[model samples]
Target: MREHEAQARTPRRDARSAATGQARRGDVSGLHYTPDKARRSANLAAFVQKTRAVDSRGAADLQKLFAEGDFIERIGALVAPHGLRIDNVADAYTMWWITAWHAARGENDDPSPATLTAVRAQAAHAITATGEIARASDAQKQELAEALWVQSALIDVAMEQAKRDPSRLRAVGDAVRQGAKGMGLNLDTIDLTSKGFVPVGVGQNDAPATTPKPGSAAPYGALALAAGGIGVGGFLMLRQRRG
Candidate 1:
C-alpha cells in the first residue's frame, strides 16, 4: 500500500443548513457538512445503505467474487482509463458495489469494451439488473462523481483506522452504514441517473483536497533504509575483523 500524506490546509467551516443559515454542527448520530461535502456525505450514506441491504449470504458471495486473482487487476484496467485507481482491498470491495449500483442505474454511459468485460465478470453478484451504460444528465454525473469521491474518503479513513487495529475496519464499515441510515436518505429512491433529491447534511468533508499517488516514496524508503543498514553493518564488521 502507498503512503498517503495528510492535507496541510485548515479545515473548512461546517456546511450551512439550507433551511436554517446556521453552521450545521456534528450531531450525535453523524457529521455535518457544507453543500459540497453534503453531497459526498449523501453519496457515502447511500453506499452504506446499499451495503447494509446485502444479505450475509450475498456478502459471502461477494467475498468470493473479490477473491479472484484477476479481479483487482481487471478493476484497475477498467477504472484507470477514467483517471481512478483502487487504493486498497477495502476500496476494491467498495468499488465493486458502487460499480454494480452504477450499472443497475444505467450510469455507465457508453462503457468501453474493457469496462463491459469487467462488469460482466461480476454480473452474477449484481443485486440489481445489469443495465447498459447510457448518457446521464449533468446532475446525475455530478452525483456519481461525488459518490465515488465519498467512497474513496471512506476507504481512506477505514484504511487509516485499520493500520492501528485491523478489527476497526469492520467497525468502520458498520459505522458508515449506520451513519447513512441515520441521515434519513431514502436509499430505495437513490438513482444516480436521476436528479432533484438532495439529502440534507450529507456532505463530502472527508475527502482530501488531492488524491495521493500510489508511487509515493514511503514504501520504498523503508526498503532502502533496511538495505543500507545491512550494507553498513557488514562493512563495520569486516573493518573490525581487519583491525
Candidate 2:
C-alpha cells in the first residue's frame, strides 16, 4: 500500500512539473498556473517601462504643442463659452502647465485660490471674446473639447502626483521656465498680477521703505542733554539778574 501511494504521488508531481514547463514555454494551457514571484516582478518592470515610455512621448508632444504658433487659436474656440480671450487662455494654460509639471514631479503644485479665481476670470473673458460658442462646426468643437480635456487631465494627474511627493516643485518651475523660453515667452512676464499671484523675487524693488514719523521721541541721551542745557540756561539767567 505504501509503494502504491508513492507511485500515485509521483504522477501528480510529474503533472505539476509539466504544467509549469508548459507555462514557461508560453503555452496557453499554462494560463491556469499562477506565475512565480520572479515572473510577476518581471511583468511589473515591463509595465513600468512601458508607462514611462508613454509619458516621455506625451511630454515631447506637449513641448511641440507649446511651441506651435496656432496653439491658442486651436484651443480658443473650445474656451470661448467660458468668456476667455487668447491672452487669458494663454495665461491660464501656462499656469496649469507649470503647476501640472511640478505636480508630475511629486512637488507641492497646489495653486492658490487667487490663482484659480484669476484663471476662471480669464476663461470667462475668453467666452466673451468669441461672441458665440456655438459658431464652430460640431466636429471642430468636439476636437477642441477633447484637447481641453487632455489638458485638464494632465493637470489632475500632476496634482495627484504632487500630493504623493512634494520635493519636485522647484524642478517643475525650472522645467516650465525652460519650456516657456523655448516658445519665445518669458515665464517671469506671464502676468499673474491680475490674479493677485505675484511671482517669487518680485515687488521688492518697487516697495517703499518705512519712514519714522516727525517729532517722535529722541534717543535717551539726547533728551537728557536737552534737559540739562535748558536747566543751565535758566540758572545762568537767574544768577545774572541777581548780580
Candidate 3:
C-alpha cells in the first residue's frame, strides 16, 4: 500500500486530518492492517473529530510528513536501524502546528497568556521527542537535535521580556557567538567600538575600502598609460620620418 494510505491507518497522526475535517476514518482505505492498528485508527478518527483543528497549511505539511514517513525512514537509511514511535512522531507534528500558529500571528515576541501556555507545551513536547530520537544513529540524532534547537529558539523569542536587561542581551550575544563558533568562524578579535575602527591587519591610515565608483580609476595610472602610448607613437613617427 502507498505511504499516505499507511499513514491514514497508522494511529495517532490520522487523528489530525479527521479533526480538521479532511477525511473520516471510515473513508480511509487501501491499507493492510492488523487489528491493533485498526483500533488505534479508530481512536485517531475520534480524537481528530473534536480537536481545535489544523489550518490549511498545517494540513498540507502533515500530508507531506506522512508522504515522507516522518523522515524516520530517510534517517534510518543513513544510520543504523532505529525507529520512531507514534507518540514522538505526533510530538513533531504538534511542533509544526505550533510553529505555524506562531508564524500566522506575526511571531510576536509575546503572545497572549493562553497562547503562551500552548506554545510552551508544544516546545516541551518537541524537546521530549528530540530526546527520544537521540539514541538513534548519529545522523538521526543530529536531525532531532536540530529540531530541538528550532523549538528552543522559538521559545526564546516568544518569552522575551521588555525589561531590555543587559543580562538577557548578553545571553543572546553568547548564543550568537557560540553559533558562529559552530560554523568554524572565530569572531572574538573583531572589535566593533575601537576609535577610528582600524580593521585588524589593515594600515591605520589606509583609504577607506570603497569600490571604484562606476567610471572612476586612479588618475596617475591612466596618465602614465596615455603618456607611454604617446611616447611610443611619437617614437614611431620619428623613426618613419628618418627612414
**TM-scores, in order shown?**
0.26, 0.31, 0.19
In the range 56-140, model 3's lDDT, one tens digit per residue, is 3323332332233323222223212222122232233233333323322233232334543443344333333344332333333
User: Which ranges in model 2 have alpha carbons more than 4 Å from their true place?
Assistant: 1-115, 130-135, 159-186, 191-243
Rank by lDDT, descending? 2, 1, 3
List runs of model 1 lying over 4 Å from the truth. Answer: 1-135, 176-243
Provide the overall lDDT of each model, using Cα atoms, as 2-decimal numbers.
0.31, 0.37, 0.31
The Cα error of candidate 1 at residue 75, in Å, is 15
TM-score result, candidate 2 = 0.31
- Please, what are the lDDT tens digits per residue for candidate 1 over residues 188-222? 33322222112234332121111111111011111
Residue pairs with clashing backbones, model 1: 15-34, 37-203, 37-204, 38-202, 38-203, 41-203
Q: Model 3: runs farther than 4 Å from truth?
A: 1-148, 151-155, 185-243
Model 2 CA RMSD to the hidden true structure, in angstroms: 32.4
Q: Which one is best on TM-score?
A: 2
Kindly list the per-residue Cα lDDT of model 2 for residues 1-243, writing each as its tens digit.
Answer: 999999999999999999888654432211112223343233323322332354544433344433333333434443344443333323334344444334334443345556555654443333334433223333333333333333333333333333434453344445434533443335454334435323445642221111111111111111122112223233234323322
Native-to-model Cα distance after best TM-score fit, residue 77 in candidate 1, in Å: 13
Q: Arrange candidates, best TM-score first.
A: 2, 1, 3
TM-score of 1: 0.26
> Over the full model, what C-alpha lDDT does candidate 1 score relative to the true structure?
0.31
